[model samples]
Target chain A: MDLYSKEVMKHFRKPQNVGKIKNADGIGKVGNLRCGDIMYLYIKVAKDKKGKEIINDIKFETYGCTVAIANTSLLTTMVKGKTIEEAMKIKKDDLVKKFGGVPFIKIHCSLLAVDALAEAIYDYFKKIGRPISKELEERHEAAEKIGEELKKHHGGLFKVEEELHKEYEK
Target chain B: MQKRIYPHTTTRTENQRYFNRERRFLFGVGVYLDYAATTPVDPRVLKRMMPYFSKKFGNTMSLHSFGQEAKADLEESREEVANFIGAKLEEIIFTGSATESNNLALKGIALARRSSSGGGRHIVISQIEHPCIMESAKWLESQGFEITRMAVDKFGRINPEDINKAIKKETILVSIIHASNEIGTIQPIVEIGKICKEKGVYFHTDSSQSLGKIPIDVNLMNIDLLTASSHKMYGPKGAGLLYIRKGTKIEPILHGGGQESGLRSSTVNVAAILGFAEACRISKKEIKKEAERLQKLRDKLIRGILTRVPNSHLNGHPKMRLPNNANFWFEFIEGESIIIQLDLLGVAGSTGSACSSIKLEPSHVLLAIGLKHEQAHGSLRLSLGKWTTEKEINYVLKVLPGIIKNLRKISPFKA
Candidate 1:
């Protein structure tokens, strides 16, 4: 029996955004050879008269399995009309839940796609010369706090964490 | 919410099916689950092999300087394979394939015994022996040597007691596969080896599928003779090894120019041997990581298939099977149809053994494990590999059930 719904296969087979946008407002490329999965996301954002951010177009090219493709496709559809803040808040677990829950092993693939989305949003803000949002900064701080707690619990979790914490504090 | 896009609508029409099929369908980057059949050749192994094919290309048998260099590389490869399998460098004999290795081990040993002792002419092999060992035993019977076939249990594993009971004073050699290729059931080789040792009989194991996937300590297992194919371990095809433990006498199968220590005669396939050695080395380094990842993917795929497909049953041992192996029998669908459908969706895998896919017969391995002919005929094997990713597994998880449902609709068999 298959674990994914028919909708997931359809999205995977014919992924929505499969090419790059030249001069894309926000471009995010993530993944590494060690992970055996890679993804590049491109987004063009436009702000309305009221200064509400809107994603005008989105595209992605992912070299990953079906879940990666499906999740990327789902991410494109999920963020096309949303504001920048909404897209930034999209989580890996939420994307997986959108597909009726991806298989356990492939949950990482969904996470990769979501990471690409977040990176793309961050790139958009950097390109627009706007300060990083207070909300995003708070989220980053919370994540660092959790990471610090984990390090303290583990004692010598990773020396690299100390460096990252110093950067965040600055 | 939009309605799900079922895979059923993508079926080829009766008239236009052959013309419009997608040629290179990909399953995306999902967890690869099919490692038992074959593995992607490691890049490091390929890197080590590139020089021999182009710059260092020379016949190992030639007496020229280039030939001597080639010959040195060949011998080094032999040593690496020997060290990997826990055998002496001189004990390793390169063969064209594990099938060839098994034939040589059985026929070579049998011929040697007939010529030397003239009395120990009987041979014993497990009922679950790979076709190579089984067919060789049959050929030995045709040559007037008696052959004994040992029985296996429901999980396709032979009991050591059965081997002990089957042995006789006339038993010249006992050949068994280290692991069952189809079911991924690893045999108790140590116990069988001990039995053969106590009886003073030669024990040979066809380790073609198990060498790179599992830990193989020939000295610890007491295996007197073992066979391995490079292709099964992510190396090039047409290269294999036969580990003949020192002092196990075997007549030469190919006699010419005294190559492979006068056992098998042929100019060494230096490039393939080097590649095989590299594959073995890389496997030794990464086996722990690969096995763990493959096991996780195998479990997820198995769970997804079992939970989604009603009345589907797993064919092999639940936990005792290989980490990269998962074989399932769908109640009403044929294995071939599912494989073809999966191929159409861009997923590449085998139904049973790729070698036996053309035979149209139910897998003998499945039958030996008490599966009815129908269940045996409908078995699908998805062996994971190192290149497999979580993306591939999820794609399979999503696409396979729809394919099965469509096939079941048209199948004549009842669940």
Candidate 2:
């Protein structure tokens, strides 16, 4: 059975923002080989007219199924031109709603896209030394623990918290 | 191997040149390459089945003329299937499905023999029997029986010597699959059968995947029991058969109104059985020429994908595989992703790996062949059928290379 909506298929057929952005401000690399899904989400942050930091550009490279890739593609469109706090407000439910619906089995795909975006935002905060909210910090910590565990399977391809940080610094 | 950093140069093959994000993917008519899962019923079989459903439907054991007619046709159908497999009319027992047939074969013998004084309490099966057999063996173990799961080589082919060594004085039965459902590796059942015969153990091969595809002579091959499915061979779904060689001591798993010599005791679905018989009839007539046709097409697909796409490898016994099956796995990508992209382009295929399963595990069959978890996850099974045309194959060849290239781009792993 088709696990994605017509809208999801539309984006997945021609997923926008699929390539990597070099020297990006914040990059979120999440997922593991065990689940056979991973995403490299790149974001270029800029200030809008209100002098608030906004997602000027976003793109993703995801190793996943229909919903995972489609949601990642749709996610780029959802957060572009939105302020960091506003983009962070976007949740997995919002992505699912925007794409019509992702099956219950594939809810994790949308969750992964949400996690990738959140991780990118956290990375941006860390890169610029901005004060982070306690909730965001907790979620990031939890994601790191899961990512760290998943990393044991394939440490090379699945870049986790510390390794991803090291890569960005280099 | 070190992971290549981002912005690493990827040598684009000729196929990748066709990947234009701007040019819309040409959605062709749905091309089915997953015939192993199930086949649409043949029209001839359906026509033969129609009368049995409404007109000649009756319980085989009833005293009335309606019952007599159904009973006559049932035996005729049984004889036809029995003749196809070179087994006697009395040896064939009809069941609901292949799963049921396999369960009956494993558990029936285990139960019937456990009570006898000299009957052995050990069963030997291959490492890669269908889940039905595996679960039955596990259940038998819980009932205080010993099970020997013999291993297969890298190509998923079992060595007869290993089976010969694994059998014990207490071994009563040995079950192995004729051909693998996932990788299409055909086992050497004839030699295994001889070894079992020499050792005084019954040999049962699950021929659900190979029954109509390959010729079987149970007597010549020394097979004591065999299982065959209908839906897999362009017949109805509700019928399956177990060939219990005459004089084999096996008890019925399902006890109801005494049917089929009281082996499988249920009012038989007359229509499905007739349809299955007709399917066997047609398959017997066309098996030789069709096998040749499918073999050529299968090889074309295998060669096309391996050459067109880089970092792709074939699965299963490359030389000893089934005529219609071609299984492959590409590096640095998941099978579900490939299936979705193929589905969008109007092609149907299956993956050995099931990421969405509750356990989140790849196919055990692929893992048994010594593939890594990620390698197993990337495996795809493309099986051809009578309806598969050259045009459909050409369409797949045109699209598959690009699909692999596209998914590999997003895949984090490097070749």
Candidate 3:
């Protein structure tokens, strides 16, 4: 069976935000070569009305299959110009629903995209010396642990997708 | 290959221009470069096979004129297949697939030796054998047989000395593949076969990938048993052959209906056997001319990709590999992503990346060749077939650069 959906292909064919921001405020990197995927997300933060920190621009560099690249592309389009809280509220399921649906096996690609964004936020908060939420901190802790696990075992049987899948979604 | 030029020296032009180009299906007949996986059955072979389904649909085991007619046809096909490999008519035993034949060759000899030989329960095989051979050896290991997996050089060539050193008083069998299915590196079977013959050990070679592409002679190469597949050579899928030398010590693995002289037992597939025989006939006739023609195209494809696309290295032996195969691993980019983007431009190829396999691991053959995990993930295999045209190869050379460039831009690893 084909692993790509028409909606997914549309985004993969032309990822909207496909470059890095020069002098970006925050950068998040996730996934690894062993997983056959790696993602680096860059975000530019600016203060808006109500003194809120909003994402002015977001872009990503991804080395993965069609679904993973498309997930990051759709995510950049969805969260642009939104407050940090609003971007964090956008779950992987919402992004997956936007694509009609992805193959169940490839659902982890969306999870990587979502976690990459969250990690970017975590980086931004740490950079500004602001306190991170307990929930986001816990998520980062699990994500970081898996990243360590990926280092020790080079080619795992189940791979990081199933492990990350069991740990948490975005 | 004697002079390894570190391929990191490359120049990147403005890749932004390619992203704006029109994305349309550019070719009418999509370029099929995955011939190593399987080939479309030859129309002539199919034509010959059509009548067997209904008109000549008689069981070879039946006791009637219809049965005798089929039985005669079956023997004729077997004779043709045997002659193609330079074997006696009775030496060829048809099975369902190459995997089955491999299972039979490994287990049959191991089990036979276990029961007959005095406490000899050891076997030796190369590390780069197909999954069937590897798994069969693993199964035997679990059943109290000691197996030694011989390693290869960087070019995936096995040394005969390793085979000689691996042999022992208890070593009963040695199995190796004639050519690799993944990287297409041909082995020194004649040397290894001679080594086995000198030691009085049984030598079996899996020729599934090399039967039609190259020459094979069982007696001349000192091969005691060999395996060949049909679907890999433009024939039907359900037919494969195992050529066992007349005096080889072996026993049957499949005991049913006592077919194929009691070695392999099942109702014969008349149509597929006929098609296999015909395919082998055509391959024997055109092997020389087809190999030369393909070598020219293969060289062109390899040179064009290496010089045109920077940071790419050939996987197998530069000259000793198959004439129809060209494997490469580009720096910084993964293989499946490159395949997907190439498929978008109307080219079908395969890769060793984990994303493309059900087992979710990069090719073990690549790992055995001592490539880094990241390097192995970035491999692509483009194998040619009978219908592969010069124009199709040029199209691949034209489209592959942009795909690699785009994927590299997305990748974190830099060249």
True contacts kept of each: 0.00, 0.43, 0.40
DockQ of every candidate: 0.01, 0.30, 0.27
**lDDT tens per residue, model 2, B1-415:** 1111112336444223332211123223578898899987876799899988788988888999999999999999998999899999999999989999999999999998988888899999988888899899999999999999988888999999999999999999999999998899999999999999999899999999998787888998899999999999999999999999988999989998888889898888889999999999888888887788788889989998889989899999987888889999887778987888898788889987656455567787888888877677788899988677667888999999999988877654541
lDDT of 3 at A113: 90
Q: On residues B1-415, what C-alpha lDDT tens digit does candidate 1 reach at each position?
A: 1111223456435223322222112223333445666665655577798999899999988999899999998888888888887888988999888888998999999988998845698898887788888788888899999998887788888899999999998998989888888888888899999999999999999988888878899999999999999988889888988999888889988989888889889878889999999888777877777677777888998999999987788876787777778888776445654664576576766665211233434567887888765455467888877556576788898988887775543321221
Candidate 3 chain B, poorest ten consecutive residues by summed lDDT: B16-25
CAPRI-style quality class for the chain A–B interface of candidate 1: incorrect
Better of 1 and 3 by TM-score: 3
Count clashing residue pairs in model 3: 0
What digit string (tens of lDDT, one per residue) describes model 3 on residues A1-170? 35588889898888888877777788777774345677778999998988999999998988677787889999999999999999999888998899999877677788889999999999899999999999989888877877676555434423533454344322
lDDT tens per residue, model 3, B1-415: 1111113423232222221121112224688888899987876688889999999999999999898899999999999999998999999999999999999999999988898839599999988999999999999999999999999888889999989999999999999999999899999999999999999999999999998998899989999999999999999999999999998878899999998998888999999999999999888887887788788889999999999888899998998998898999987677887888888887888898876766667888988887767677789999987777687889999999888888877654441
Candidate lDDT values, in order: 0.74, 0.84, 0.84
Model 3 captures what fraction of native contacts? 0.40
